[model samples]
Target: MSSQKMRTAQIVEYNKPYQLCERPTPVCGDNDLLIQVHAAGFCHSDLQVLHGQFPAHLPLTPSHEPAGKIVQIGAQVQGSWKVGDRVGVLNFKNSCKSCVGCRQQLRRRHRTDPRFCQSREMAGFKHDGAFAQYMLADPDTTVHLPEKVSFEQGAPLMCAGATVWGALQKLKPDVQPGEAVAIVGIGGLGQLGVQFAKAMNFRTVAIDNRDEGRKLSMEVSEKLKPDLVVDSSAPDASDKILEFTSGEGLAGIVVCTDSIQANAWSLEQLGNGGVMVPVGLPKEKWQFDSSALVFRELVIKGVYVAGTEDVQEMLKVVAEHDITSHITMLEFDDIPGIVEKYTDKAMKGRLVVKIA
Candidate 1:
């Protein structure tokens, strides 16, 4: 247990910057766990929060993706999770179980009481997140970090990994073991998506624009043995993807980045009856060709943060496959540098903080 209260990063007003201040340790209620944050992943999501783009509570801590060991528990938690269990924190701090998105009330607040939804408090965004030394979590949403996994490897998975994994699973429902699963973009979410696609036995393809992005993406394909890796910036990148699929078109494409032009080009690259699932959020509008969809019968869908069932399946898939993220570990002081210096270059291969 900690000796005293903790210091946390808070954003008191919109676009006003963040503040680090000391505050009393939160009480770990019965259904919750007090995590002594060993590492927290500074995300682009946090950037949105800092800009006040995230739709959430104010005067809240903004670090969400986190991993740490349990230091306390509330009275109502009955899981095997204990004070010493290592766990990964999720983004949906408290997803109202009654809400349609949380899981049709599936990750229900109280299993017996449908009226009582699970009150999972998201670290950083919804409440004071993992930008501090400690975080509060619900056993229902927190994934138990494996003994073999380092704190840094699991931190980003709490958010970035889960979001992409969730999208990939939705795109590939019953594909043959070796069918092609293409992922667009190789940033935070795409990198994990590429790895998970390969790990799940799909013929994985990694696509990106920047040379460095392509270089980093290939690391997963090279090490994990993906079927193909293409830089979408290439003059004939669309045709290259077509070549990999044997002119039959990919079984499914998960567009993890929000570049509208890139995604539209990706749609063009799709073969007959292909599906495009978009995960990234863009500020601008996206235009689609109705004529092409009508002729080819293409399918397009937009995915949200993630469903709770998505979380459950991802935790299992990550565990069963023994997937370890490629992360660059940093200390707490790197936050400002991440925002100011490396905003665009930051991707899945690196985690910007080791909070403990």
Candidate 2:
């Protein structure tokens, strides 16, 4: 029997529950590496895929934000990522490696190069993923983790954290130290966003409505010493932003919440030319008047997860600045309940599932 038949997660449809079963441990392709997942975070994105918001090949294994140890590699893969090396997984699947989009975004280093688009395949979305005991990844596309970080702490950095990093970098180029920046929805992605933004020398502020989440946000803020913190639940949250900015307006705002209304509210609160970057893809269209964007001279853009190179550079950034995520660990089989528990509003912070 093929070795892969020893361990795997069975998936029948995009909307169905994930079933755990024995299958061969997946093998690494010529450009790939075989990973033994020690921990894979249950991202909200996974829940989205479960509900069909994100398309996937039927019977697909669903997981992207994973951290683990590398056990084997295909020929031509290098960079000292040998067996037993710590690693983190990013959300991007393989791109054509030659298409414009792939060149521009598949690998962060290729963002400036116009010749690198196109990918051969994708993981989680286009093929099987880390929901199983083993997953195959292209060596060119994986993120290496440092020894200092634990598996759970490194899990969300693979996806949620990378998404936020990409969004924040897009907003604050040469981010002025102490500039005020706001992070919407202090959960899985937002929590890490707060830490990274604060580390970048920006005065990070987190906006969320849940009392527990708000408390968590404040707790993180206290550790980082953001210039100001506000509760989205307050009737006058907008006023609070106004007060905090002293009427000058925020330097930049990232709408991490999935609520279109909250995103629209961000535009109104923006200072002249303030950039509003959306890291979350709401189910429906972004509800807002086109005219609102033109008059304010606002720049609104959305970011997909991130590219291979972005993962590498981001790791260096995280290490140099000491950024990390608030993660909760569960067994590999806990995926079903993990997805079921995330109501539209109750879920916050990243949940890492142990796969070993």
Candidate 3:
């Protein structure tokens, strides 16, 4: 293949194995950076795109969590960004200034974040993403990878870390430091949620049914681990949490798994006036009794992938606190294997593909 052609693992059809093909390398647009793809991480969102649960352009390359070095900088890009800068790319791109999210006078007051604007370009879903030798990245949502963080680790942080970081941020106004915050479903995002909660000085609790998930919550981070680990499958699970908090229940809960049962179960663990943030995208409808909201005054809010500033701040925390993603590194040749293992019921940690 010529230098202009790059190998890509494309979703040529829904519910099918990825097709490896050589396609012309994407050109750097005026507002984009051409990245020499090194690592791409698979998450639940990738599985959704693969199985056609999410709308996607056909033959799209899959992987929203991508990390690499810039090989070419767009002419219109500002700042110190240049060739050879290691970076992680978020999925959202090209915000339309005319959209409701962008046109709001106050960004924080906007009902929808500009990153979720309907007209925005979404890598992996609407455009070719990192499962390739090269890909285009929007500078707006990209962050530089620290020297302490590797491409493999940075890849998953783009989604998993930023997402949990944003979810935890939502709890700050309601839950004070040293208050109890439980991280439900300790896997890729959950593991990080546990760490980030602790880093934020919340009394962190890790909850998961799988032994591996519980074990991972305590093992993933060197400096920070949950204050407690609870087996959600235990017959006395809710009671255990209540006992730990002195019958107050958790001050806040971040639901990271897509299981409707898990999400519903999390709602029962929150104290009165507590908040719950659901970051997982589940296909099944999430059902909850209205009594909890009315009687407990509980707040449940949805979070998509975090915005650009949040991602950048999340990286800073990861670097400062020595936070690390528990990653399973695989070769680009094993794209199919990556997809298969990601579907495992007990899959723990993030699966990252080395594409270089």
- In model 3, residue pairs whose N, Cα or C atoms come closer than 3 Å (at least 3 residues apart or on different chains), thus clashing, are none
Q: For every model shown, what is its TM-score relative to the native structure?
A: 0.88, 0.89, 0.95
Q: Rank the candidates by TM-score, best first.
A: 3, 2, 1
Tens digits of lDDT, candidate 3, 206-286: 999989989999986555888889999999999989998999999999998878999889998999999999987776789
For model 2, the superposed segments whose C-alpha errors exceed 4 Å read 1-4, 100-120, 289-292, 320-322, 344-347
In the range 305-334, model 1's lDDT, one tens digit per residue, is: 564456656766666666666677766765
lDDT of 2 by residue, 127-147 (tens): 777777778876766778977
Per-candidate local distance difference test = 0.73, 0.73, 0.86
Error of 3 at 187 (Å): 0.6
**Which is better, 1 or 3, measured by lDDT?**
3
Error of 1 at 308 (Å): 4.9
Error of 3 at 147 (Å): 1.1
- The C-alpha RMSD of each candidate to the native structure, in angstroms, is 3.3, 3.0, 2.1
